[model samples]
Target: MFYYYEKDQKILASERNDLPYAQGKPIPGAPIYYLVEGDPVLGRGSFKVNHPGQLKAPHGLEVLDASRLPEFPLDATLSAALEAGQLTAVNTGQVGWESVLSAAPSAGKKRLNILAIGDVGSTLLTGLKLLGGGVLSSIGICDVSDQVTARWEFEMGQINLPWDYNAFPDVEVVPVEKLFDCDVFVFVASRGIPPVGSKVKDVRMAQFETNAAIVKQYAKMARAANFQGLWCAVSDPVDPLAKTAYLESNKDENGNWDGRGLRPEQVQGFGLGVMNARAAYYAKRDEKLSSFLTEGRSFGPHGTGLWIANSIDCYDEEISRELTQKTVTANLWMRELGFKPYVAPALSSGALSILLTLRGEWHCGSVFLDGVFMGVKNRYTPAGVETELLPRIPDQLFGHIQEAAEELKRVL
Candidate 1:
């Protein structure tokens, strides 16, 4: 079954078996859904582009929940169709499907480059140097300060033992011009991070106006170099910064928008993983909420408007809200103790989550959805950007996701 919204707020549903192949072409401006059995894939569909000269038609674009919808089996037919580009999943309000699932690069050593070696970046460097041995070929360190990059090269070089030290990848200082010449480019550059003892409740947003400017320069750099790799945004206010990188890279010097540079799927925010880990930290303290240890999922942005589900199977709104508040404010606790929080985020969100991405494991991060970068459980697979499709998402939880997306759109 397929369903779509009309101008009159009416839902038009059709079963795949009933529709003829002639009508298989999607309706322009309308979102199309395919029911696996009777369940819908939440916030996912196929959107058709309207004709250039066509009349202003009804826009059938809205995020829909699939919690009540039945489970859709990932059968061979669907996989083959996806692989052949015959079927694609679209986010709400997306005009057309652009990312095509293709055979991904075989698992092997990847060259990772990092920009900046500040508190967060240095800690991230340590984690990657120690933890990314299995998959990383080398760690390229780049910073505006040559001293910073050289220092890390010297410090990281001393960590390995004299005997059997070939297990770890080499860490080298990379020139700014060569930053993008790697499999993954992690952006950790920022300006105006709030100092300790500041009364600001939202430190992440405070860095946004400045960090956005910093990231834009590199976005254009990536364009000029025609770079093709993962553009990881590890700066604060991660989701919006990721979008800024995407939007700026595709724009010419005159500011004309061009569909070149980084693709939407290539830029992802690495902030959600820490939020998920934070929720789990709290969930462990309370035995009653231990379900989050296994079944809980985190969604939305890195800072404000983060949403945490206690457990999809046995959801409790009250418990979920508490978890979210804790997860969102976990950083404040460190600040309250007269210290800045960087270790956990660098390790959990930066090093660990990125490793999971390379391994094609399920990890929480922000991926481009529709027109905004929204945080969700997504993985990089040969099949393309794969988001978690649950059997049922609680209504209250889905509403939170919708609201978080709206908040993210507002940030742009």
Candidate 2:
């Protein structure tokens, strides 16, 4: 059963007769519902309960059940059809993977493949190696760096220096050839980053132009190779690069474009992790301002004049002004602290984001917005990436976001 939701009423059912349920009458919500005709055990219907609780008249679409429901597992019909996997409880002590999904991804271990293991790439490798989740059998790391590759292959296999590697023992470096043919293709390579000098301006966005070109190159390679797996982009300027990869993959040889081969939905970017970090920094100053960590928002590029809006409920003109200043200047503070801010970005932007994404959790990052690449903090669910919509922001903050979009468009 599938139905369309209206703020005031259940407007109608899907015109597609192939769907399983019933139509909804007028209701005071924007939810659509789905009810499987005869599935009585779990209940005949499900409300589209997504993103905590905002649905007044929750619509039950079959897809919403993929991760949220216990009976539904990662069966092809659910995982692919509904775009779901069981969601892991962040509280592992209270609940484990067993409770999260209808079925776990399988205790049967399989090798994970990574492509372009640069700074972000290597950090991600470290996290995954430490995790050594049974979902991963082994890691196939690739990079242009023989030394870096060799070092990772040597380091990841050992049980010393940082964390217990034996617990998460499956990690290794591999050539690019082997890298492409794995279950997942983690694209952490970038055309440029970690600028050699301090004089580089807007360094994060500068990587955009270069990485976009690089992404276009790889899109063709993946398409030709018939790659059919998760393609995660971790390099800076992630959202646009993901868009470019999809765009390039779908372009015909003659340059005509269509949404085929690699669909736009196939890609995801990791830049939002940095924004989340900025928000966290602001959150710690005081209890009243803590929701900046608790409820703050950072949903755009990692460059100058970025968007950082404190929560409306907690919004104080002075506090927000200060928090915004601090969030924007955090990177510069790192350089002032006399070290490149690589590890945190790597951990915040790459490893942790990917882990959260794979676990089907909410995250701050870019997702396709308004029919193109737009950054909105979102969560990964069985159905696909869903961007979170914030309440109406203060007028000044809204102006900044609008300006940020315009700035991004001019470059793209």
Candidate 3:
């Protein structure tokens, strides 16, 4: 059902289902369930719960109307709460409850399959298995090293994470042959860290040349296996790796141009989220740059090509430069503190992007751009990926983004 807030006998825009969000699992024509805050009676109106596993909407929801409704996306906080079992159905202002099915652990639900388990991969395994609660059913962890595989199995058996165990009950360390059969495939393995003294500040770009070659092998492997799931590049130089997977999958039968690989939409890059976070860190303490919390944007590759615009809406050249510098050096902060900064990158970049992808909301990831891989904020759906294009952007920020593209072109 459509809800309209009537304040002083007039409509004030509040929340609507037309905007993209996880509508929960349900049937169409389901009754409307409302969630109202302190003041009741503001939400008044009705509409049919549109489709199975869909959000309730006002009757006769039109395309234009859906588009016109405010486009605020349900971000990571909401998703995390919902995943950890912190939230459930709430009452509408009309003093009633919305009917919702328990998306609890049930039969026949396919879970995400992770293909590698190394430093980033092993940490990711621990986080997803422990923190995901009931949202993920089973995790299929694979690694080339027998030692790593054995280690994960031993940990999952006894090590308890903060969340209640026995909730979902299916975290498995499986063989690589079993990895391709799941709903989501994450690639974190690589052969390109330039043995010590690499001195590569731009770690992502430095690994691109080698990671590109490494990813192609898996792309072919994935295609041969006929896997139909979200393929993510969690390795460094994410944008290029994402493209490599897509391109390598499409070789023709005659050793010519054929498009049989994974769809361009199925692959994604997940490195930009950390860049956004670093910019926010610097913006909060600097009074002159405090406005960035409300108006900053980080764009382009997750590497040296990144554009950290100080004020996305206001566009201050000086502050933008400072913000960019902070983002580039954010990693060094952890290095100086005597610990590897892997935790935040694992959480903010990998797990967060995966959560957003499952929920079908916008996030920073690699997508197909002009016949190649380009980093952009977008949403992943069952059909494919759709890049979110904001109405307006600072020209100077875009110029830097273009330069990044040019630099990427030279190497890629």
Best by lDDT: 1
Segments of candidate 2 deviating more than 4 angstroms: 1-111, 132-135, 160-166, 194-197, 286-288, 389-399
TM-score of model number 1: 0.80
In angstroms, how far off is 53's CA in candidate 3? 30
Off by over 4 Å in 3: 1-110, 159-164, 194-198, 252-255, 336-339, 382-384
Model 1 lDDT, residue 322, Cα = 89
Query: How many backbone collisions does model 1 have?
Result: 2
What TM-score would you give candidate 2 relative to the actual structure?
0.70
Candidate 3, residue 326: the lDDT equals 81
Q: List the residue pairs that clash in candidate 3.
A: 1-47, 2-58, 26-53, 33-98, 34-91, 34-92, 249-261, 269-366
The top-ranked prediction according to TM-score is: 1
How far out, in Å, is residue 246 in model 3? 0.9
C-alpha-based local distance difference test score of model 3: 0.60
Candidate 1, superposed: residue stretches over 4 Å from native = 1-107
Q: How displaced is residue 347 in candidate 1, in Å?
A: 0.4
Worst 10 residues of 2 by lDDT: 89-98
Q: By lDDT, is 1 or 3 better?
A: 1
Each model's lDDT comes to 0.74, 0.56, 0.60
**Cα lDDT tens digits for candidate 1, 1-412:** 3333222232223324453233344343433232212112112322211221100111111222333333444444333443343333433232222222222354679999999999999999999988999889999999889988889999999899679697788999999889889989999998998888898889999999999999999999999987777899999999999999988987889987755667677788999999999999988899867889988889899998899999988999998998999889999998989898999999999999999998888888887654678888877754356666565677788888888988988898
Count of steric clashes across candidates, in order: 2, 24, 8
